[model samples]
Target: MMKIRKLLDIRERSIRYGSVFRVLGKWPYEPLVDFLLVYSPGCDRKSNLVVSTGHKAGLIMERLPLESSLEHGANGISTKWAISNWDEWIYPDCPIEDVFVID
Candidate 1:
């Protein structure tokens, strides 16, 4: 409980794709902490039919653990990695023209 909460508090958060989200950091990077596959994907890894949130994304990780992490980086997780993994899950990739709103 506290261990999880503590990670949330101290780490600059982003979406994850499984308990073992290769990508880490904030909008950029996060270091590995635990050895268990109990984490979820970041909320950003969604198009629809999903509750977009950091926790929900991470929670799903426990249900679907990936075999490996994303490509390692010091400047944060790669957007390419995020999108490719997301596409694997979403299938029939949904394309957008332009951003209507920025987060």
Candidate 2:
């Protein structure tokens, strides 16, 4: 059987300006794909129910494994790669919206 690996855990970095901490970096992009799929009709309709359901269910069921992997120093999944590699999983003919923005 193939071994499944978990994506990276969210990390935080403090933003400092000279003498004061001003901002913090957040993992805002990690769930962008899931959000897009859930909200966008074109993407949602084209998505495979079984695959999406299984993916979500697996995430929950494998939480312990995922956390363990992160504790053991696994790298997080790349948002850039996920965005750029849509064609690998999504059908070429599927109608993908040109714009997706989260407010």
Candidate 3:
């Protein structure tokens, strides 16, 4: 349990620093973390969901794992990775906009 918490803490810190976060999707630039998928706030017509890749968003998703796919479908967005419990997760560093853009 502590390990998970520790990992979460580290992840949160990374997010706070604008480190690369992962989600399912393709981006034009090279994300800080290449192992996982990168996501931005947006809706998918076919999926009908709103997905995000910001640190805070990922944290929230991590808390609730069961609702992952459902959330993706309902929210019309994809995640870089599958978390344990996305429903109970929270990311404090999420950008104001749903989407994360790199200029």
What's the lDDT for candidate 3? Answer: 0.28
lDDT, candidate 3, at 57: 35
lDDT of 3 by residue, 1-103 (tens): 1121222333321222122333233342223211222233343322212234334333322222233333423432223322232223423233222223221
Descending-TM-score candidate ranking: 1, 2, 3
Candidate 1 vs 2: which has more lDDT: 1
Worst ten in a row by lDDT for model 2: 14-23
Please provide TM-scores, in order, for all candidate models, with all chains considered together: 0.24, 0.22, 0.21
Model 2 lDDT per residue over 33-82, tens place: 22212211244222221112213322211111111111232232223433
How far out, in Å, is residue 8 in model 1?
Answer: 26
True lDDT of residue 69, candidate 3? 34
Candidate 2 residue 87 Cα shift, in angstroms, is 0.7
Encode model 1's per-residue lDDT on 1-103: one tens digit a residue.
1123222222333333222322232321123212122222363322122223343342223222232233442222333433445435421222211101111
